[model samples]
Target: MERSRYLQVALEAAHAAAEVIRHYYRDGVEVSIKADATPVTRADVESEEVIRRAISTAFPDHGFYGEETGSHALDAEYLWLVDPIDGTRSFVRGYPFFSTQIALMHRGEIVVGVSSAPAFEQIAWAERGQGAVLDGHACRISQVHALEDAAVSSGNLRTLAGGPRWADWAQVVQRVARIRGYGDFYHYHLLAAGRIDAVLESDVNILDIAALSLIVTEAGGVFTDLDGGPVTLETTSVLAGNPRIYAAVAELMRVPG
Candidate 1:
């Protein structure tokens, strides 16, 4: 299939999932705690089912890895990663920052990505080498070359406080122009659109970072683990942004305080 076809599939699935999310948005959806103690909602499961059905119908041979249902057929040439509702806690609290993320990986390389903030009516999508876009407008990362000039962000502070690298957060906080709590997929969207300069976080799943990885990199930014290594399915710490901020954050994430 053509690259555009892959992107179209991802976008369509994202739109379908977004609808499921919108239906439950701020309607006091029931929530349950998963084994990891993270909140999961009816909206998350329903949205993943919607995305899974769409992908399976369009490409039955492809593999799937979803936040709610887990993975299938990892050895397949193509894999779709889905995070149905990336900020379920926020969603449950009537926050509008939650989003649905979907990405297509071909032979281990991410090729197509889509993120939809349904409550905000904002969507960002990109195909490998095709650049990123927000609501059909081209998007690019900021040119802020120095940490002092950069606006940084990270995951939910409550979770980060428990992470092994919690102390590292202080170094970044003290150095950057400012920090925002635009947790989950929202940070990546802002980075890709040049609204934010960098995002750092620990305890992330591939489904949480995969789509944002492509979108940020395609927007002329860098996306990798805090050690400056390539991000993988198992990567836990992420630092993504323009190259300058990425390198600076990587240095801050170094061991031995």
Candidate 2:
């Protein structure tokens, strides 16, 4: 019920990865394409390890689900979701928007989340009742209710706007006020800060969306799959937006593949 300790540790883990990830990112990092066609890197792996060690030592009983090493279940009341270096593609290309995400979910609900974008020197986090915060300031979703006036974000145009799936993506963009391509998980934090209205993207893992879900929800936004279903570890596509436009946005992305 209390969020103090969990949020503290989550921020610590996220900041730890944030610091190390910065160094490897200076000259850019190497990338490896996964069997699923997703990209990973040494920076991503090492960052994941850093968070894993921090979490394990701080809360030995807490379970962990990481992007790199997969899942480690301790069967405890709490689960830590981690994305060591979210946006390995951007990181590999020397882009500055990638981040490290950490979250604490208790009994199936995400109660705490920490996302650190070291490149930007910003940290965004949330606790269920505490609301979402950017740095130390309270954050909220945009009041924009009309899609024609909304500012939107997506991970990558090439990845999300190409192939047969592009047809599904095109429909969503057509209805938005403007589409800005800012790849990586950092966009959700931006959405929580009220800087963006929504973020739709494909091909992700639990680690990618877990921390984001708490941040957005506590900030008065919604996080769900394209079809408006609850987000889960198995979900690869995501639709996140402020409450007013979430359902409308979700409906637009529901076209079957």
Candidate 3:
């Protein structure tokens, strides 16, 4: 497929998601937990239906994966990843931080990523060779080079509960310049747009980070696991940042807290 087609797929997926999600705006829909214990809602299912149908019709042979419904294992030349409503909890509460994510991976690399935050009234997207853009303006990561100087964003503390990982998380949080608990894909969007420096979170699904991993990298940031390897669907934790800030924070990661 042509590179421009990647953008087309991503954008259309985002638009489809936004249209469904808007039905819940202001006074929002109630939420129920999925089998995995993560929240799901009508908005989620509605958006996923739109996205999945579009993907199926657009590329009949392509492999598709999403959060609401799991994925099929694939080594296909083209794979499309979707997160209908990435921040379902936030969506249930009518918060604007929630978003829809769509990505295209060609031969194991993310060639295009589109993130649309309807409440935020902005779209941040990018492709493998082209640099990232936000609201149609080109953007880059901040030039900050030191851990102490970097502004950090993280997920909810509850995601770290039910384990000894909380101690490790606390230790890592204390080392950062500042910590904001803006959960979901918005944090990564901020990082990509250079408004935030780094983000670390755990217990995420492949659909949650699939598009984001590429968006960050195209914006001149690094997307990796906490240990600094490539961002993977199998990873339980993820660390993403501008390259310089990532290196500094990677070294600050706690060992056993």
Candidate 4:
């Protein structure tokens, strides 16, 4: 019952943020660089504000960690992680890849999540125990067990390309039946919906993928950092897939031989 309420609030917040994003997306907005050199626009800021307001109103005591608004009461028992526009670059350039992400973390474990891509007309959500849903239908992962038979996707591999894992990643790329770079919320959506078999990323923040982690996991997929660690506030990478494919990828990532 409590999880349902949290999911409802999260979905509402995501919808509110999507409205704000769509408004600016249609009217056009200026972009500015953040301290980390990433692009930000009015849609990003305003959408985050809309989401923050919606969530805070429902759970006044819960904490918030938004990409644009910064953090508030992070140590609180309940924390909402938000990325109003996860694909700011794609959004700034008039693409349809951006989305609003919202996830509730209770005691450091994500309990509810909602990912809304207004321009793409896609919304995915999940609760800890309840199944994941894309649009209005329940979603699940693919059953492809072998890397040679799996369709793989990669996202933001800048860090991995420069690190020791590049060789291992290359080997995996060579083994996969297919490879695509549907970065941001798209690949995870595909994975959860069973349209893809695996996704790899080496550069992401909790705000960007926290909601996605829960969505994929609830859909019967495994989601963790590139090192096979659980997703946390400090997570910066991803290695997610169905049970068998996930194990194969994790092993290949560790020892390409």
RMSD of each: 2.5, 3.1, 2.9, 1.8
Give the poorly placed runs of model 2, Cα more than 4 Å off: 1-3, 28-39, 156-169, 254-257
Top TM-score hit: 4
Can you write out model 3's per-residue Cα lDDT over 130-242, one digit (the tens) per residue? 88888888888888887777789887545667666677666657777888877788888889888889988866767788888887888899888765567555766788888
- In candidate 1, what are the lDDT values of residues 1-257, reduced to their tens digit? 23487788888888888888888988988889999899998999999999999999999999999899878998789999899998888899998888888988888889888889998899988888889998888999999999999999888455668767677778888999998978888889999999999988866888888888999999999888766677677777778889888878778777221
TM-score of each predicted structure versus truth: 0.92, 0.87, 0.89, 0.97
Error of 2 at 163 (Å): 8.3
* Alpha carbon RMSD to native, model 4: 1.8
**Stretches of candidate 3 exceeding 4 Å from the true structure:** 1-3, 27-30, 70-73, 156-175, 254-257
Give me the displacement of residue 68 in model 4, in angstroms.
Answer: 0.6
Q: Summarize candidate 2's per-residue lDDT along 65-159 as a digit string, tens digits.
A: 88788877736588888888777776787868788888887877778888888888988888888888888888899999988888888864455
Q: Please list the residue runs of candidate 4 whose C-alpha ends up more than 4 Å from where it truly belongs after superposition.
A: 1-3, 255-257
For model 2, the run of ten residues with the poorest summed lDDT: 248-257
Which pairs, if any, clash in model 2?
A: 155-183
Order of candidate numbers by TM-score, starting with the best: 4, 1, 3, 2
TM-score of structure candidate 2: 0.87
Global lDDT scores for all candidate models: 0.86, 0.80, 0.78, 0.91
Name the lDDT value of residue 1 in candidate 4: 22
